[model samples]
Target: MPDAAPPPAATPLAPVPRLDAAALVAALRAHTGEEFELVGPLPGGQVGAALVRRPGRREEVLTHWGGASDATWARVARTGALLERARDAGIPAPRYALVARLPERIAVVQERLPGEPPTRVDLALVQEMVAIAGRGAGLLRERRDVPAAELHLLRSGPGFCLHESLAQYDERTRRLLDLVRRIGTGHASRMAGDDLVHLDFHPGNVLVDRTGTVTGVIDWDSVGRGDHRFALVTLRFDLAVPGTGAADRSARAAATRWLDNRIDDLFGASPDGAATLRAYWAHMGLRQVDWAIRHHGPDDVDRWLTVAAARLA
Candidate 1:
């Protein structure tokens, strides 16, 4: 008998559909039975948004949509509940008017707040924002009901860490990956925590008035239970991104310094503080690189990889 032929390799699944203005408006109308005029696209969202004028409402609201799994949807609902609790406790955050779960996407209609992100993040502004975040963290500290499994970081999909993805990259990235693995393994015990963490807390997600007052914090899609220090790690990385404008560059430098000082004040005296901080930084880099690989171009990948490499080095 002739030898049997080998099975062909499996084809990769197609990327999820990104909802644009038209699609978002349609989804909102279908799910909520409310018509909204498309204002325009909101800037700086990793997941896209459509600013829509709601009928009979004086102020405009935002409809945000992104590719999401069932688990993601569950987490979003949990986050919305957490936000409501935070609001009750005097924490400033967006109120979710509606959360529509479509076939492969989830859309959230939230109250658009009055302020915009600060044009320049000076030290004073950073201090104010940190205080605001601290208040929210206080509310989160009261919650002990979320499951440990759900608290674990989900890196966009099933895979949690970056080791597998880094294997596909060059030697430089792999070296970074090795360091990430070492740090993560050393600090694995500290990964689980009961505090509510806004995994993507950063300047872009922060809304501030003209006077640098934090009016509202948006984008609760990545909220979960973890060390609050992890959130600060994310903020530091966000501030360190290379910027095009002089103000942006200065703000980044200042914000980075402010966050370092704050972290030092909070944890510098602990025996394991430095190691724990390094571990969180490594995790942030891995998370950014993995997400960029899937959603962005090579240059984006290289940029985040470089950031991670520098920290790990």
Candidate 2:
């Protein structure tokens, strides 16, 4: 029922729990007494998400929270309010309608927003997403209670941005891990500042219409406080990777180059600009590489390796 519990990801990634959609639906019914109909899993999900609807309510996305820690839940608690502020600031992030802490596992019901994941991150979308990042430039400055973003550059993150995958994947990843550790030693451990940080900011998280205008940004599960510029690094890594349906290789490369130039232009002046980017890229390198190792095929891993090798080195 839960997609056959994808064969346990290889060691290191083994800790990463595949989202159990059927179990979540059962948990929702048992705990909330809401008979919601499953509308199948959402596509292009780095992590799993599903669509659900009930008779009287509009469709909402259901996110499984099987492997998140208490700290993660704590962040989720404040996320709703933070998203509200983000909305007020003109960033179209989805709001958490309900966080159901069932015995089976935590399940999050989020407000379903508009648009679909764009097939490609063309120049227009890149510019738009970068502009949207500016809207929440100092969003969390006053929210002293929220946790700053964890880079996990040096160490393994809770379940996602792992280090072992790189250290053990291959010679290429092993070298990348060395650089990550070096950057980690330079003190980029915790992302500092008040700007809103969506750790997983990428094309998959944002939705757009045919004309490529971003309709909404979803998947705020990893939302936290940090220099929003960090998101640029994440987007850069996500865009550079081979997948993403960009039919024209040259165009994809051009878009990524454009974003890289923008990142340099924007972050080059900050005090810790280079250091911070090295750390962000390191974390993203480990995250994407490890994900490819665990969830994708060998060809995918090789493609990721080529992209990561080019950047993290």
Candidate 3:
């Protein structure tokens, strides 16, 4: 039997959205000529966004709240343009079109790429995307020579990366902060140069087809100049701790093993790569804890923070 091609890289997570579906549809319909049908919801929560199927069309329409900032809509437009540029650059990206932009929301009607939701947290799939992430990192490193700083998630400072700037989070936030400090300060690993990092890479964001063939790597919102190793570590963290308890240990280990080897293949299993990966692991974990605290309620916040604290301890 022929070995199947690996799944595509994960999509970058979007800012949580409180979508106004009706309003978004209205705006989208007004702007586009095609009819869009109501498909089932995407896997993530309502705040995450939904998938709308266009009848007789191979594409999907993704809608999300642009948050409160007046520039949020503009950012969506810019993101679409960037995706187009990336595709032209020979990157594996979905065909994208911006259909509408309202004061409160934005709608992107884009090609629905092949592949199913990631099954069993495969490391090969993770590395497939990490390689792309590294490519993105290389791009950012090249772009650093340009006079202008590209608008990207990497532009956020240490405070944002560490989650120290948000005002509303409480105890959970503090716990995450403490962990961030330990992870960021630990001298185990360090690297210089600002390469692009896709801070979010998980099974939920990745896709794999039935034959294990990776079709297209979607999502580019978080692409920016930063540490590429950090991006790889962020994806690897989820595999390191796949689930809440012992039942998933074997799976986690398998995934980890695959990633460990792949990391070595791409970056080489050298002291420098190891150190760089360690730094990224710490940063990525801290970021997850911060996100859980800020975006989730008491139950989730408490759970993630506890896990984070234990790791730091």
The model with the greatest lDDT is 2
* Index of the highest-TM-score prediction: 2
| lDDT by residue for model 3 (222-306), tens | 5544555655555665664446556456666777777767666655655566545544544555556545544554454445445
Given candidate 3, what's the lDDT at residue 71?
67
RMSD of each: 7.1, 5.2, 9.5
In model 3, what are the clashing residue pairs, if there are any? 6-214, 195-226
Alpha-carbon runs more than 4 Å astray in model 2: 1-12, 67-73, 243-247
Clashing pairs in 1: none
User: In model 2, which range of ten residues has the least summed lDDT?
Assistant: 1-10
lDDT (Cα) of model 2? 0.78
Q: What local distance difference test score does each model get?
A: 0.67, 0.78, 0.53
lDDT of 2 by residue, 52-85 (tens): 9977999999996653567656666788788999
What lDDT does candidate 1 reach at residue 31? 75
TM-score of candidate 2 on Cα atoms, chains taken together: 0.89
Give the Å shift of residue 213 in candidate 1.
2.0
Considering TM-score, where higher is better, how would the candidates rank from best to worst? 2, 1, 3
Q: Point out the worst 10-residue segment of candidate 1 by lDDT.
A: 1-10
Per-model TM values vs. the true structure: 0.81, 0.89, 0.67
Q: Which ten residues in a row have the lowest lDDT in candidate 3?
A: 146-155
